[model samples]
Target chain A: MHISEGVLSGPVLVSGMILAAAGTTVGLKRLDYDKVPRAGILSAAFFVASLIHVPVGPSSVHLILNGIVGLLLGWGAFPALLVALILQALFFQFGGLTTLGVNTVIMAAPAIICYSLFGRAVHGATRKAFAAAFACGFLAVFFSALLAALSLIGTEEKFFKVSVLLLTAHLPVMIIEGIVTAFCVAFLKKVQPGMFARPGMTDPVRGEKGGGK
Target chain B: MTIMTRRMNRPKFRVARMRRVGPVGFVLLLSASLVLISGVPAALAHRVNVFAWVQGKRVHVQAAFSGGKKVRNGTVRVYDSKGALVTEGTTNVKGEFSFGLRHKEPLRVVVLAGAGHRGEWTLSREELSEEPETPASHSPGGASTDTSPVPGKSSPEAVLSREELRLAVEKALDRKLKPFYTLLADSLNRRPSVPEILGGIGYIIGLVGLATYLRYRKEGKEARPE
Candidate 1:
């Protein structure tokens, strides 16, 4: 979810931007320039993926494949995401220039988690891998939704109010994203199997049978 | 009336006396006259409003104005947390403007909204920091640290005269070093546009196609070994 300029205090926006710079710097330190073109391509896919919209409650929801980007690029996803988001901010004003950092951190954290935890496990066994992929995608979206909810938590009393609104808004989209992630992982298994072989692709691979269904 | 007289001299291919026209022609004539009369007054009322978001020596200003009138000119100014003026200049027509700090230290900025507009906000570098920092100083640098309010003139925090604010913004804008501006300009160059959508789509298609070709090619290699 995008945060408009002026929605957050200048201090918060600035702090977030600073953190984003640090995160991006850390992300860049590990980047392999050979894969940069691929990263750009995937980032573009991530950008366009969100354009495929589905109506949820009163608002429309779309896929945020940041988890998939994380799975593919690891730390590189942070910078890639920053680029895509900066573009989105400039073109669509989807988020304000001031709040870009907050939005990036919100969207990218779930990606980092999903890639770190579930990415490799998804490559281990077809059914198990797809299931884990689905869960990871779903969780990333849910976590982002939660962060967005938490951002507004102080302004509105009771977590339930924001949680209910956010979860309700994201429910359909999360399901859609989960299914897409599952299919995409399955597709990758058949095609670019070496993608799974990438170093640090995921945190230590999870046991096959124990993976989420 | 003065604004109208200036426009009349430009050149007109068509002219008609509205009062002499028949009822049928009157409505058409009246609409035509209104359309011609409405143009210049709207142009005269136009003025640009700029909102500058400053981070340290780096700044980005966005311009918007009433009735879709584009920003013609504006600038930004940086003051050390103190009231002393640091630097100023005119902005590009895009309404985008920038400035830099040599020290990499935080500073304050007083943005003149635009030409002929009063100044608002005494923005500080702390306002643009990504993380909180301990504020170092609070003076107009070399200028008298006079926090004393002038009776008729408002504090810089409250507002400044339009021309003074314009100059302040100009200083803030012009003070940016070329290198930082170049980096920002380069990033902006890579910025995606509607045309870039083709590139995005092509990338996805290539990914899928490359994956397919690689898979088929791998299968062929395995069969040859067999």
Candidate 2:
């Protein structure tokens, strides 16, 4: 979810930008040369996923898909998500330029967290991988929604009620993304086992030059 | 025998990789279904939309998410053209807000829905004025003559009557065409088209390609020295 311009305090905005800038630097430094294509493709997927709205009751919520990106790209999710968000802001105005840093941190930080918590498990036994994938998807949305609500705390009154509502609004989305990610992980496991290999691991033919996780 | 077994597994691996294409196909299928489901006439994403118009001495505003859901109890602030805060209030349960026009100049109305959703609308000076142009002869007497129109019944009273009639007509017309206006706004907020999605993807690919090329060149330079 995007925090529109003028909704955040000056301190919040500045801090968000600083955190985002630091995250992007680390992400770029860790970005494997070979995985650039994967990062780009996932960035595009993240961009388009926002347009897919799944109707819940009266209103509809779109897919963020940041969980899958983070699981696959690790720290690369930062740069990938940032690029996608900037394009979305430019093309569709989903989020304005002024709030871009805050929006990027809101969506991308959870992805990085999911990667740390569930990334390796996604490459384990079939059942364990499925469980981890589901958790990754669910937790990613859960945390992002929480961070979004937190961003509004400084600007609005009744912070708890608004935060709860924001989190509840995304409950269905969590389920949908969990199922989607589980299926994607299962498929990738069967087709491209190399994708699950640790970053910098050397293949007999490709050596250590191969890209990210 | 081991070589033959490895050869056999290679084909199987290739086949499995080919089937990996299934995930890409699944994503496309899911996107297609989403497009079909959300293609309904008056649905949009979560972004807020606001619209306002001058009706009589008050400005009427409606604020809602792009999905047509009302933004109830949200704060609505009004500012004059000179950037001075004119008035501030909250929307009713119906996502509708109205405030008396304090100044004849243009006005900006901003709706701040909690959780960082916001919508805004601006009304030009012409839209707020009852008459488009001033009467050339009455320029000097315009200010003092507004309230004492009974003394000069012919000029000021006629203008007042015309203003009243125009407001009545505009109100009726707004009510009659309310559905059309809502529909137009809903369509404007519809999900991005397939081409737009493709364009975004293209940009991402191009950006990644550039990054990859730069990385490759840097690595090449290092390897040449080695």
Candidate 3:
């Protein structure tokens, strides 16, 4: 879901940069040294994930995997995605270098939103956790599609039409992401329950089975 | 049995080592290997490319996604230097559109593939010169027919011969150079190659190292004050 170069206006691009900077600040503040390696791995995953295309929808549709990144990192999704998007723009012109801010916001905002919405529910091995993971995966892309369309507001396109078109085109991607996110969460919960950040100082290994509120 | 007892005596070291091989590192290694095995750099997705060049009186445009998928029925709008719509049409099944221009005056061609996927190329006035780079002057008489002329055609032999030779050279050059231009345009918006993919991952790792270094430096400075 990369928006190409020279499409957006000056104001939209500037505002996007400002918001992205603010988000990254918060993310970096919360992200401790212990978490930097995790962020890096997730960022690398994001860079590689966009290369795999599903070949569905009006245009090219690919797996973003931002939902999983968000579920793991929350606000940390901002800086993580920023790194990946920068590399994508530099190496592969999927998005413009100037529009990096806007593109980062488009991908990261939904991820942060999804994490806030479904991050807690999917913190365990419960079936409910898997269900929330699916929804998180599905909704993250849905919100990202909406944001991408919204970024075109200052341009020549009609907002309503573009939003509807983008949403419909990503319909299959939504389902696919949902399943992928669920699978990752289930696997992580079984293997490393400590991956998901808990609110209190709960033992990550034992908390997964009995920490459900 | 001695080694087993030694391992049992070093639970602290084992726990410390576990911290090093965290779940994130495991996932990274697993995913990196998966990518290496899949060889996904061959076919990238979504990135759109628009290439326009001048040929005879018409400026032709080709619009396609990075993975060689043509933008079928994509809306193509051509605007002149003054930002006025000069020619507008939909790309054909081949992702091609051409419009005759009365005057060069520089033109911008924008292609909307669909759903906010847009690509554009500007055609400079100099490119649309009177003398087209392609074989614009070639007659319908096929290349084979050039050598064996009609027995009774009412044309001068010397003038016809010079003209025929020029046309033949133009045709050959155009065929050879056209692919070069297409290659150039494709690179302007290309899919990720194997080297690029590997390099990008390497860059991410470098960034990670940089962040950790900065972090340690900051902590070290604070500890020195204490």
Best by DockQ: 2
Docking quality of model 3: it rates as: acceptable
Tens-place lDDT per residue, model 1, A26-88, is: 777766444455566666666665544454332345567776677667777788788777666
**Colliding pairs, model 3:** none
Q: Model 2 Cα displacement at B99 (Å)? A: 2.9
TM-score of 3: 0.79
Candidate 3, residues A34-57, lDDT tens digits: the string is: 778878988988898887666654
Candidate numbers, best TM-score first, in rank order:
2, 3, 1
Tens-digit lDDT track of model 1 for B1-226: 9889768944441222221222234224323433443343221111123455554445665443322233335455656655566667655666466665444335554433321122223445455553222222322431233334455544655433433554466557656644565455333322234566565556545654665676678889999977
Error of 2 at B106 (Å): 2.2
Which lDDT tens digits does candidate 2 get at residues B1-226? Answer: 9999999999888865665574465456545644564464434445778888765456778887765667788899998878888899998887888877666788888988767878788888778776333344344365356547566455655666665665678678878867876666555544556677788888988998888789889989999987
Evaluate all candidate structures by whole-model CA lDDT and list the values in order.
0.56, 0.76, 0.78
Q: Model 1 chain B: which ten-residue window has the lowest total lDDT?
A: B40-49
Ranking by lDDT: 3, 2, 1
Candidate 1 lDDT for residue B38: 32
DockQ of each model against the real complex?
A: 0.03, 0.48, 0.38
Candidate 2 chain B: worst 10 consecutive residues by lDDT?
Answer: B131-140
Per-model TM-score of chain B: 0.32, 0.62, 0.63
Q: Deviation in angstroms for B47 in model 2?
A: 2.4
Q: lDDT tens digits, residues B156-205, model 3?
A: 55446756687677567667778887777666656678899899999989
